[model samples]
Target chain A: MSDLNNMTAAESAATKAAVMNQVPGPEIEGQSPLHHADLASLAKQGPKTSGVHLRELKLLGHLTLRCNPANADQLAAVERVLGVALPLQPLTSSENGNYSIRWMSPDEWLILVPGLETFDIETKFRDEMPGHYSLVNSSGGSTVLELSGENVVELLKKATPIDLHAKSFPVGKVVSTLLAKSTATIRRTGDQRFELVIRRSFSDYIWLWIQDASLEFGLVVEA
Target chain B: MLHIYCPHCGEYREEEEFHCAGQAHIARPLEPEACSDQEWGEYLFFRKNPRGLHHELWVHAAGCRKFFNMTRDTQSYEIKEVYKIGEQPSVVAE
Candidate 1:
């Protein structure tokens, strides 16, 4: 029981790294759609480069918690269990180094932490968070695609109807919107780097769509 | 596309999740003798079709299924603001 609650940072990180290594990383074998564009030259052209930072965010812990934000006791219990309070403000997130929580809805949120922390977070939530709340483990259900080239925002606007303007969606903003036939929790990680959370079932289709959309720009699959 | 903010869900969803309901904030006259014919006609039939920014009511059919108001730009399809029923448009109200 004590072993479950207390884990060294290094030990947890190493375990997480091992788990990620085992999971079949992004299938780099297949040719990406925008393979022909010259990324080196496009980088000089600016943010429009295709396949700018296509990284497969693997083995990251993803959990879904649904509860009433009006319930102050439940919110406090969740904070105590995770050692980080859930971000109640809509579309906002609070991260404590390894753990980050995204406000998904008035009664729902997505909590992300190191991959190995998945079970621990779940156990803690189950033990602490009370009332009519649900915690679902969705790590295997979805994966992340980081789109960072200059043209990435333009490419996303083409795929989704949502406005991707800097004024509307500044850095640190997260949105769960439609991506072609699938759903994506799009997050702006940096100035040019945008992270997309896509479900596993529709990954192949969206991947194909992304490749096709970014054809004019170069698509580079990072190792 | 219109961004409809759901009061229950507390997030602005795509227009696909919403269905337009035209104008809101309407009230029915309590007594027939209390209002004139012109006031009754205006209440029953009048609607604003502004060319630029317009206040329109929408229902979150796919999400919380609640009715809400959205202020949208007619030309650019940009949603300026979204608020609940009985509440003023925050963007245009400001």
Candidate 2:
């Protein structure tokens, strides 16, 4: 693994350029330009490294599943297919390898898998799980960005009103909450890192918000 | 400028998402045999125009379309509590 801390500013810029060049996402056509801030400069500046680390989690497979948790057979089928049990313990997650499942609501969940494995997982669920469940292939509809380092929790509070105290949101917890003008499913990935699941339509807006919020602290954007 | 909490969405949404249902917690007279005309008159006419911390009913019309209760400070327009229609408030009105 690359030594993120050892990377020079020039190297950081190069990595960002490469990533942006490689995975140039389709431009959102009708997105009204943000009035209060410059989104492009914000996305370019990324997160402050000293207090917050931001990385664009590009090309991951995101799927939204809505199903009746009370249906034993169906729930079991999902478990068998995902290898990780659906976190039925409200506002929790179950991770297996690089994949994780977040309980979005009583009947909904947000599943994150490696970019390459997204399609396969969706296929498996379609073939295996049964009943009145709706699985939407939101892989192209949204993206994940990892926010780590110190002050992440404080940054989150600035964006949302949800009680994010450690007692309320411990590790292995996931919550779909309002982030500024948009919505995000925030999952605690580590002691300092959080994985934000944001929709494509509002990705730019949230990215801009993160940059402004992390300005006082140094921001480090990783590929 | 109403802040309404959606039970299904779990977000305190803008007033655009909710519709007010006026007074709540009014118990209907079970039987005519047990109630006087004055009691019925009081029940129908005596609405609590509380100055503060009033429990009002609202429907998440644009969201889950579910009815819920909101304990609000009428003077400042600050919501103190939001609960499902059948559930009790966690904190009592001050």
- Candidate that scores best on TM-score: 2
lDDT at A133, model 1? 62
Candidate 2 per-residue C-alpha lDDT over B40-91 given as tens digits, one digit per residue, 9 for 90 to 100: 8988888888788788889755334568788888899988888876788775
Find the number of clashing residue pairs for candidate 2: 5
Please tell me what DockQ candidate 2 reaches: 0.09
Model 2 agreement with the true structure over A1-223: per-residue lDDT tens digits: 6654344434433443211122233453322223234444665666434788777776676778887788776678778878878888767889888788888766778888876566667666666665556677677777788888888888888887566777766888776666785777788988778998887788877877887998876667664
Considering just the first chain, candidate 1 attains a TM-score of 0.74
Q: Write the per-residue lDDT of candidate 1 for residues B1-94, one digit (tens) a residue.
A: 5445676566566777668898766678888678899988988899887777888888755444467777888777777877877888767633
Q: Please identify model 2 stretches exceeding 4 Å from their true place.
A: A1-49, B1-94
Q: What is the DockQ of each candidate?
A: 0.13, 0.09
Error of 1 at A183 (Å): 1.6
TM-score of chain B in each prediction? 0.77, 0.86
Query: What lDDT would each prediction earn against the true structure?
Result: 0.69, 0.71
Structural similarity to truth (TM-score) of each candidate:
0.62, 0.63
